[model samples]
Target: EEVKEKAQDVKKEAEVKAEEVKEEVKEKAQAVKEEVKEEVKEEKAEIENKIASTGNYPDLITSLKNNPWTSGDLNTRVKFEDIRRQVTLHEEEITDLPLDKIKTSLSPESLVDFLNMTSAKPTILNRKEDTSYEFTTRDPKEIDLIKKRYGLLDREIDKITSVLIFDKEGQKLKEVKDVLAEGKNRIYMETKF
Candidate 1:
């Protein structure tokens, strides 16, 4: 009977020890879970900044204003909608150049083509803050970029005649030319900074 009693005592102690170990394991798991939640909370804001917002001029305004990527003299990544425009940045030199009022020396080969263009009064869709933009015309030759009211950066569009799409390795992907189409005609081009 004494031997049986000792065995029962040992069994009771073993069960208590097992319960204590189980509770310790649960506590450690809860601590790890809390640590993980804290890490995600810390990274949430930074991750939100990297997420890109894509839309037309109005939709992009908020993104540009809040962009964390744009610091002093840092190049910002931008893209225009299909056929409307797209801005893929290359070359790392950052310059905020100021231009004096002067006629551009660089002439486009399509200048002769532009002479035949009908007179147009287009409502400009681009803002001065935009890194790149496109001008789409509803009617034939109805878009004119030469405006006295445009800011210095906006006037840079006058210098660009065509867009040459290139891959990362400098291989030419596509070249946009001055073409008159039946539907919306776009002058998709890139102005070099």
Candidate 2:
């Protein structure tokens, strides 16, 4: 009878020890899982922060690519149309700004002194008998700078023989430039007729 009791007691102790080990393992697993989650959160945040620091067009594309909606997950919901609308609105706002403001904002280097250095005057002359108009500039460099700055490179000083000039009231003035290779006074245009 005493042997039986001893055997029962040893079995109970072993069972209790096994249960305790299982609990310990469960607790360790839970702890490891939490640590892994924390590490993942930290890494994700680090990557996002790194990307955010690059505030440029390429970074914007990267951010869109990194989104859950773009990761082949059809179930993820995103407001892409709203984002596109906002971008359009911002573009419209930029386009509505005055020319001076746009120039001040986009001028890479201040060429104010260079612009002031030119002593050029644009003149438009029209003769009743002539079929064409005449537009001329004393300093072609100034005209070049103005045209280049305003994205009007199509009209060039040397190449353009005759051009139509518009007044404030939108009247077409006949203009011509006299092509002078070497002279004290450079005449921009001249019409034979």
TM-scores, one per candidate: 0.29, 0.31
* Superposed Cα deviation of residue 7, candidate 1 (Å): 1.0
What range of 10 consecutive residues in model 1 has the weakest lDDT sum? 97-106
lDDT of 1 by residue, 76-179 (tens): 22122224343322223213222122122112212212322423322333334332222334332333322221123332232322222222332222222222
Off by over 4 Å in 2: 53-193
Highest-scoring model, lDDT: 2
Candidate 2 lDDT over 75-176, as tens digits, reads 111111123233322223333223332222212111222223344332444345333323334466755554454344554334222233323332222221
Could you tell me how far off, in angstroms, the CA of residue 128 lies in candidate 2 after the best superposition? Answer: 62
The collision pairs in model 1 are: 80-85, 80-86
Total backbone clashes of candidate 1, pairs 3 or more residues apart or in separate chains:
2
